[model samples]
Target: MKKPELLVTPKSVEHIEDLISSGADAFIIGEQQFGLRLAGEFSLKQVNEATKVIHAANKKVYVAVNALFHNDRLEALDEYLMELQRIGVDSIVFGDPAVLMAVRELNITIPLHWNPETTATNWFQANYWAERGAKRAVLARELSLDEIIEIKENSQPEIEVQIHGMTCMFQSKRKLLGNYFLFRKEAMEIENRKENKNMFLHDKERKNKYPIYEDLNGTHIFSPNDMCLIDELTELFEAGIDSLKFDGILQSDDYITTVTNLYRQAIDAYFDQGEEAYEALKDDLLEKIEVIQPPLRPLDTGFIFKETVY
Candidate 1:
């Protein structure tokens, strides 16, 4: 619909390099998890390792530093952020406002893409980040189609959407069952009760015994959803969005291929024939894509224009 562009956002540079070798136009490299070091490029000797390889293949790279980090980690982040800037990382995607401001303070900068986990849903929110110096903002996974269009129309920065992969239930960085699993199991004697709620179990059977995470207001829920946007590619492009992204760090190559093919075919078909062309190929498209894990709730269109879910 709009100019066809593909952004390969790998969990790290290894997968990104692999995707580049395969056929990705751009990359988003995040090193925070590994302590803020570029994966492939080791030292000054490997100066060109990241930039040269990707540039040689005619690809772009966006270094994601940290969506969430403490004030203490700022000095540690400087060197990594500086390296990305010096190497001219195409853009930077971050969730923390402090990180955003710190990058600007670096004096050497490029496009700053807001991480979706930060939740810029409405255009006013999107544009707020734009004015604060973000180049592109990944629309929140919860936004509806209409909301996406509205964001595109109003936000000054370029917009990108995650068209495929696991949709996270909590902020990318948050306390989780990781602690609940660790502490609750060991210290709580109730977990060892002869007849119990079975809270130790990972999966549920009966609704009454269901393991629901309770928040102050209610229960906080998280489920995996396969994002297959092939059916709506045309409308999105026509809406003036800039990029389509895929989420597949946990998927196999075949899964990635299937996701890629459907979107690619949908885009190609729209220009070649009409909207009907993609519809004609819809069955095969749907067939190629299968959900490894469906949301416990059900398949949702996602928040392109409305609230995440009722």
Candidate 2:
């Protein structure tokens, strides 16, 4: 079986060198002004410098411009994209059709990676983007391994899947966190300062608590548990996944290094030895991952084995 490339999200410029050294095949960098990852944003100069560092190491960098665009941001968007192409970015990851349209209209030659949030759940949607000029499609987190296999067998574009890290359960353009707190203060007639704070939502029946935060893009509710598919590396590779993405844009450097290294080791083991030897390394991998991940933060295989109901 062919070994899949490991794609990682760097928390900052300081974290770039370690990630590259940890056997990451590519790095996904984003800026706060235009990308979805507000916390892990890098300045343009920083990104340009980082691109040089990554290129020197013979790796690739994909800039995340995966934000929904409004009419006002078009001119700036066009200019920024030109700057990215000039910097020699490998491709741009996008979720908005308008942004895709803008790229075509401006005649930007950089390859586009389509990630239409949760819409890429089947082969038809994957092929639709492929036909429209997307070089790759990041499959939805909601897909099962069986579904992904079918899509890969049928789709034309390269396939990318989130093999590990935090899975977002809800995303909204509205400032739900800020508005909720404001309404509470008003209804109770209390004076309070507007501050951005991390909040949690509790589920009595399931006894689960999920993290909620707001940033430039909007409010986001993430799954209580981070996704971990270390044990499934062999299966994913066999399924023809072109790339495996590790989502840790908001996590610590240790988290990024440990996860990337673990996946790197796992992938190497699979290709070097085979399935049985790879299975033997799972316990060690999980233990190392547990040490670096946040205390009490749960981990699971996400929806890879089970189906999700609408």
Candidate 3:
């Protein structure tokens, strides 16, 4: 099989065209933010439209139904998903078993890449889904680089891990943040004071609020350290992993340059100079933020190291 390519998804039709224009291996169209902000409407029409344009340019597209949905919302998801299938989505990312089973029931036939939110670790579980027609599993974010390598070696399925992006620090359930914006609307205003780092509070519905910290000093509010494996390309390839995924739904031009360039250089070094070249590029692989007008957080490699270096 060919080596995996880098993917950057614009958050919506309004902001992603520039990103699509910039060169990337593919576009994971229809990110989580697309419909929620569209004034009481949500649909995969954006992905459908994006796929047509991207196909014309000869780039790949993956639609992400990548959110944690309540049981009440499954029916709506099913209907939208049918449209995705009819539109000829290259691949669709999903985590809910109900969603998975529903899609399969219709024999949609498109590849279903398991989203990490479902949190299925262990190779056997991955293969179990593969037999059921899942094309790949986007491994859990909590995994170490070694664990990721192990998953690739042991899992019978093709494994893809996030190579770069912001992450939620909590366990993968993502159910904890069920706190609604309607309940207390004040959390967004507190910014990041010491006493108010996490401003969200519990509401009458019994759902706890997700605090939005304004840590002026660094990345805050459920931000995971960015994963930049630019120079580590050979190690990931040698580990037998299939894809190196990048996170963030349409953000900035700098995001495009910093991420894609690093991987491009890393992949080239792998074939040209091998490990020695890779080692040299590893040092100072990150570019200084110059000015984090809002001041971003320092990075965390998460559990990627052999031991928990972070």
All candidates in order of lDDT, best leading? 2, 1, 3
As for candidate 2, its clashing pairs are: none
Better of 1 and 2 by lDDT: 2
Q: Write the per-residue lDDT of candidate 1 for residues 1-310, one digit (tens) a residue.
A: 4565676554333444566654566765554331221222233223336667777778786766534566667786666677777777677777777777677688756777887453666788778888888888788777778878888888888888877664555432332434454566643542343232123224544431122232211222343345567666767868878878875543455555455556666666776677788778866666556453322323334554345444
1-310, model 2: which lDDT tens digit per residue? 6778899998777788999889999989878567875436688898898899899999989998988777777788888888998898999999888778878887888899998767789988889988998999999898899998999999999999998888778888897866886777663321242333346788889878787777767778888888899977777888879999998845778888878999999988888888788899978998888777776468888889887776
- By TM-score, the best candidate is 2
Candidate 2, residue 220: CA error in Å?
Answer: 1.1
Q: Please identify model 2 stretches exceeding 4 Å from their true place.
A: 186-197
lDDT of 3 by residue, 217-259 (tens): 2222454245555545666777767777766522354665455
The lDDT leader among the candidates is 2
- Kindly report the root-mean-square deviation of model 3 from the true structure over all alpha carbons: 7.3
Clash count list over all predictions: 10, 0, 8
Backbone steric clashes in candidate 1, count: 10
Off by over 4 Å in 3: 14-17, 20-22, 31-43, 171-221, 249-253, 280-285, 288-294, 306-310
Quantify all predictions' global Cα lDDT against the true fold: 0.59, 0.83, 0.59
